[model samples]
Target: MKSAARHAIDLAGFEAKFRAGPDPWHTLTARDEAIKRQRILRALGDGPIARILELGSGNGSNSQALARRALKLHTCDGSASATQLTRQALADAPNAHAWHIALPAPLPGHRYEAVVIAELLYYLAPRAMQRLAKDVANALAPGARLVLAHHQIEFPDNTQRTAGIHDRFINALGRSVTKVRQFRSQRWIVDGYRA
Candidate 1:
């Protein structure tokens, strides 16, 4: 399959969307999105995560929830506006920090107890995806958790399906990573792994 990075929406496109509206994807009001967030949290469980790195900080809805469960939450997005919104959402939590960055690039340089990549992997090309998988594996501390959530449907801008994205991470992480939790529905898939 071809990489979506070649033709998928670029950083400017994402920034424009965020600039146009606070909740471009209706992340706060969408039923499926709510369900997806719930599933992601459930997969991560109720324990306290010392450090968390979230790859996509969409309007900070998920980030806000994650911040409550983590001692330190670092979240980033390609859109500056999104990052601003994330910061606003997490204003009460001094432990949460948001950065604006173009993804498919290197992740933040820090080993984390947990990492969450949600609704963001399909935008990456195979090479970028592989690189990210490697980065994620390296960033994970021993016994750390990696949680992934992606929509199952194919879209024009997406390079891979949910299953394909999860498989790529599993393959890249090799035998050291093991599945800890999973949830699948017609709309989306959420998988958790332990390193």
Candidate 2:
């Protein structure tokens, strides 16, 4: 199959697998992430900070955590149901904005204190990756912080190998890459990039 078709199949498989469990992975994953997410959230700083945005705001777990701190928080996802869950979960909270965005598109506006994109990049094809990266980097202010977590390569495959190498290449496209010492279920996290 072509790479794009392969990715589509992969995503379909993911949807079916996760959809098997009606509530999906976000909840259990969030509970597992609770402690480390605290560290990530704290790194973004305790605000009076105006705004924070979370990409792939799955099940609204992490976004809700952020709404507690930021003056205003925006949560976005490509999926309508996911965005709906985000809004519903955050409805009781005051400082929350939730939206369903079509990916590979530029963020609606720039200037945010921090952005979290957890496990979102690999879903895009390589062509889309560059566009997405450009949009993300351009959307940020010079020193705006980004938190990027990836698909856990618990065991490697050719695609995973390419993904790792892609990270190095993408890192160079921006100013610098720094490895963040953190744990999200033994997966790696990278923090702070000019990109």
Candidate 3:
């Protein structure tokens, strides 16, 4: 099935949502979020990662955890407010950096040992998602890992369901990046791939 054709959320919408309140998604305290975080970390494994890029810095809750495992961590989000929160959350981690980047754009030009994109893809339209998947595939170093997490439930603003989003990425990534792990709950899905 084709992904949804709805327009992706614009920068203003993200800014307003972050400005209205912190933790708008309850990522900091939600039980499911916590579980997803743990699962993502487990998928990344115990080896020290030289560099990690996180595409969606939603309040930086998950970014904080990734920072601990990576020697250098770069995280970006579409909203300035969300990026600020991520910076604050990673303040103590000298190796962590945050940027406000509207996505469906090119990824940072860096070969990373690992990349985490959580709760972000559904916000993008089909073509945007395809572009991002290609960018992500290019950014990953040989033998690098890519971890994706998304909620299973549908939202009115989402341009795709979790499966569609994941499938698009996997297809765009091609045959070289193989799936290494998968975790599914009633509300969420996490998939790990190795390049």
- Per-model TM-score on C-alpha atoms: 0.91, 0.74, 0.93
lDDT of 2 by residue, 1-195 (tens): 533323232444444544465357555366556665665675564455576778877667777788887777887877666677788779888888888785667675577766777766666656666677776666566556666655455322222332463364355345443444344445545443332
Global CA lDDT computed for model 2 = 0.62
Q: Between the candidate structures 2 and 3, which one is better when assessed by lDDT?
A: 3
TM-score-based ranking: 3, 1, 2
Candidate 3: which stretches are off by over 4 Å? Answer: 1-8
RMSD to the true structure for each prediction, in A, is: 3.0, 4.6, 2.9
Q: Count the backbone clashes (under 3 Å) in each candidate.
A: 0, 0, 0
Candidate 2 wrong stretches, greater than 4 Å: 1-22, 26-30, 46-48, 154-185, 188-195
Q: Write the per-residue lDDT of candidate 1 for residues 1-195, one digit (tens) a residue.
A: 864453467677888988999998799889988888888988886789999999988789899889988999999898889999999999999998998877767776579999999988887777777778878888899888899998887776665655577887678664487888999889789998888
What 10-residue stretch in candidate 2 is worst by lDDT?
A: 154-163
lDDT of each: 0.85, 0.62, 0.87
TM-score for model 3?
Answer: 0.93
Q: Which scores greater on lDDT, model 1 or model 3?
A: 3
**Candidate number with the higher lDDT (1 or 2):** 1
Residue lDDT tens for model 3, 1-195: 974455546678888988898798899999988999999998897878999999989789999899999999999999999999999999999999998888877776569999999999888877878888888888999999999999888776776765667877788764478889999899888999899
